[model samples]
Target: MDNASSQINISFNFISDISNIDYKKKKDFSNVYNIQGMLNIRIENELFFSEEIALLEFYIQVKKWLSNKFDGSFYYNTIEVEGDDNPLIKFVASDNNYFISSPWGQDKVIAKAKAESLIESIKIFTEDFEEELYRTYKLNPKWYI
Candidate 1:
């Protein structure tokens, strides 16, 4: 497959039913544990995963992985929502190529792109997600220790 044709698209919306929950804390920070959202991911122009997910946990995991510097390969499992099983997503970087895969998917290699291209896509997704959280909730999430 042509690296130029590979793509990754992600978008999510925060569920708006947290009025009863105490999300705010001291120092103007908040927790995302109770927050819910529909996360949609598409790879190579095809829908890969679309379902409700634990928005905060997902963000933290992705952020942590990105902070690791994308060394050799990175793996992440989506936090199960509403009793659903976690979906394993893996990204392998080798020789300037990136291979994305999932055990639950029909194919082993769900998508492939140049290493730089794939990393850029993920960075954009993370930045956009962070902005959305701050815009909607008006509080920064307490970093996961």
Candidate 2:
């Protein structure tokens, strides 16, 4: 909560894929498939998502945004932030874009701060990943994106 402000505003909207496979897979879960595709980012204290991938090229670019390891899971091994208990988020290609939604907040934000800082914490927690995890992640494109 912001100390200066009496009320704290929370924004959260999890977009689900519009498909039986996507819907059933997501099943009201945070990490599933964004049928319309999403490029989530955070600046200041707010979060945002480029909900629509109008072009196929953009879809590929967004898919390339993440490292291909997680199985619909969202977690920073460097930090203990719990990605939803479900599988990790996945990128499924589709032509629908206008149906994109706002950049929604995750149900659980281990720390209410910038995305880069939160990622840094997780890197430190991993223990075996790297002694220079933060230093490395700092150079990552996501930091600037």
Candidate 3:
């Protein structure tokens, strides 16, 4: 693979009404948990996947993946977030490369790129996302990354 040609892009289009969240009540934080959004992933300038997902939950998963040093596979189910069972989207790492695929039947790699590139992309995305959360929603939730 040509490292120079590999790239990863992540962007979210939130569909939930965050203004109604009552920050005073801890239980109301569920509003954040239930926040829905469209997660768009692009690799090598091609769309890999675009799906509706739980925004906060998905952010937490990505943070966990970063904290784990990309040591193993990271999985997230889009349908599961909707309270239904579904196939999982997997990110697997090997020899410093990350392969993303939805392994419902076969090991079909959707996109593959270097770990450093993915990490850098995620870091940039996280920083901008955190800022947006703060500026737009006054949320500076505890981040694990």
Candidate 4:
């Protein structure tokens, strides 16, 4: 689905920026995964960012776009971030000042679909997130590979 190489650069840029975002600190609470194919993407940046409300808006946008492209598939079914306690990305936002890393993601691929469908889903998903680069990656997602 992604014949052009334009998306690679965009996706990389978005992933690289996650560490810079300063997530809120709190215990595990309720952040609604109100959409289909909502997966966790863990990123670590050296520079800390401010204003999670902006970040939250970015996330919602990313999820919706990804869902449309992948026909409803989420990444990070099991993800590991770059700077998490482990290489595997795990993040849990409790409030506005603390984000915790936990190795609790599962390693499951959807069993109901054919391998062809999975491949198509991944391709579309990749492109979808890529579109968010420069435009709005925060509104984009870290939909795992």
Cα lDDT listed for each candidate: 0.66, 0.28, 0.67, 0.30
Q: Which candidate number maximizes lDDT? A: 3
- lDDT per residue for candidate 2 within 22-67, as digits (tens), equals 3243333222222223334343444433232312222223333334
RMSD (CA, Å), each prediction: 3.7, 16.8, 3.9, 17.2
lDDT of 1 at 141: 52
Show model 3 residue runs off by greater than 4 Å.
1-5, 26-29, 77-87, 103-109, 143-145
Q: What is the lDDT of residue 8 in candidate 2?
A: 21
Report the C-alpha displacement of residue 52, candidate 1, in angstroms.
1.3
Local error of candidate 3 at 74, Å?
1.6
lDDT winner between 1 and 2, please give it: 1
1-145 per-residue lDDT for model 3 (tens digits)? 4543257888887776776666676345465566677777778777776777777676767777777776687777554534433435676777777777754323345677777887888777777777776676666646322
TM per candidate comes to 0.73, 0.20, 0.77, 0.26
Candidate that beats the other on TM-score, 1 or 2, i.e. the better one: 1
lDDT of 4 at 113: 25
Candidate 2 runs further than 4 Å off: 1-34, 46-49, 53-145
**Per-residue lDDT over 54-137 for candidate 4, one digit per residue giving the tens place of the 0 to 100 score:** 223234444554456434323222122244323222122222212322343333211122324333433554566446432542
**Candidate 2: Cα lDDT at 110:** 25
Ranking by TM-score, best first?
3, 1, 4, 2
Off by over 4 Å in 1: 1-5, 24-30, 78-87, 103-109
